[model samples]
Target: MKTINRFFVVLAIALLLSNTSTIAQEQTRPEFVTITTMHWNMDNKDFKMEDWKAVEKEFLDKITMKNEYIAASSFYLHRMTPDNTEVVYVQSYPSWEAIGEAAKRNAELAKTAWPDENARKAFFKKRDAYYSPMHSDEIYATMPNAKTMTAKPTKDMICYVRKGHFAYGEGADEEFDATSKEYFDNVTNKNEFVKAYYPMAHAWGSDRTEFLEAFFFDSMADLESMFDRDTELFEAHWKDEASRKSMGEKGAKYFDNRHGDYIYTYVAGLAK
Candidate 1:
């Protein structure tokens, strides 16, 4: 957890050395993101999805929603993974220092939310029962040029994730950054089918090669439409075949020729 939190500090220093100008231009995006992979306790025969959601909502309202240091918090349930028991919790911070500050804030809020000691204990016990002990965590650094949402969603959305591996021998940092920002501005942001998109690279995880792109859609139909719309946007944005090929080849140089696709349902009520 400490290593994961420290990623933003390391990321900030690297970015400053390579591209300090960007930091001054865009300060709204999350600096760091922590992803926790956990499993539902299948052994508990009394489990109900609503009950779990309710418990989580209680905690979110009490702690996460009130935390000044936590920029954003969300929960994602496995939709198309190999296993059904997986649940993911994602939290983003404004700065690396905010990670430690948020923990301290949560403790203070928890006490205020449940003033009675016994009630606090009972609430936590109930919450803990819903999840298994086994869990893993990874931290990622948000890349430039994301397709941000125009408004907050009121319902659960389907999230399609494309995970790629970085090749690391790409040319100058300026070339990759310029190309990525240009592609996102011209093509990605124009896709009507895609509600929101986030591109992240590994920061403090086991696999440094990891690069994950999450695209959100209103439904399964919209997700399929996004692919068709992607081709249309790409062609329309880059008319000539040579221009398209050049853009593709330049982007391809940054990543290995391998990626994995995963799907999840983003719970609106559990979001902060």
Candidate 2:
């Protein structure tokens, strides 16, 4: 009886230690989700860029800074000439489950900041008009094998946007998907600097578009390197200049116009 009691006590201690270690490991694992909001530029005739900037500087900045769940945030302006539409903002959260909780906390904070319910609603209403009617988000597991760029001392992270327009015709969607697969297999698979890529669609507000691809990077210098790297990959895979140009032309014909790119610095509070 005495021997059995000692053995049971030792087993209990071992089990307790094992459980504690597992919990610690789970807590330390770095997992994050990105919540992206898309909106169209305010269509109001009285819309002023200065006023928008002020709101960003005052309310938006303050709220984001105070939010604990936000890992990073960024606001981007479209650089393309013809597509002057503003990209608005993208924010990151520590986890997908935290998204709803974060929003609830943010609302509570806003109420405390602005006691008047009408005033709070008005502020958000104005803010919401800056983005497209439809925005969707997806969660991606960061590739463990990929190299991660160190965050800059200034807390600025560069994002490189690469938009792909789907081809036109009865089988345009099929062709676009096939091209994407080829691009990923022949091009992106070999590129080391491609940090992250997301595919999007024009659901509402904007005209119907087959696809949009957003690529992320740490710096503009990396963007310059991609051009040289991508060209080499293209030549190697296509074998001839004519074949390469044909593929490019076919891809371009799918869109009403050329695809767009925009660069923005990730906000400190929002970036992971």
Candidate 1 on 1-272: residue-level lDDT in tens?
Answer: 22211121112112222354775467998888999999999888999999999999999988999999999988999999877899999999987789899999999999999999999999999999999999999998876667787888899999987776766775677776666665566666787888988877777989987877788999999988766666676667678878866765665555556667889999999998
lDDT of every predicted structure (CA atoms):
0.77, 0.51
Error of 1 at 181 (Å): 2.1
Segments of candidate 2 deviating more than 4 angstroms: 1-30, 35-37, 80-88, 145-158, 162-222, 229-272
Which candidate's TM-score is highest? 1
Worst 10 residues of 1 by lDDT: 4-13
- lDDT per residue for candidate 2 within 112-190, as digits (tens), equals 7778999888988887666668765544322111223444334444666544343344324445445545655666556
Candidate 1 local lDDT, residue 102: 95
Native-to-model Cα distance after best TM-score fit, residue 222 in candidate 2, in Å: 5.8
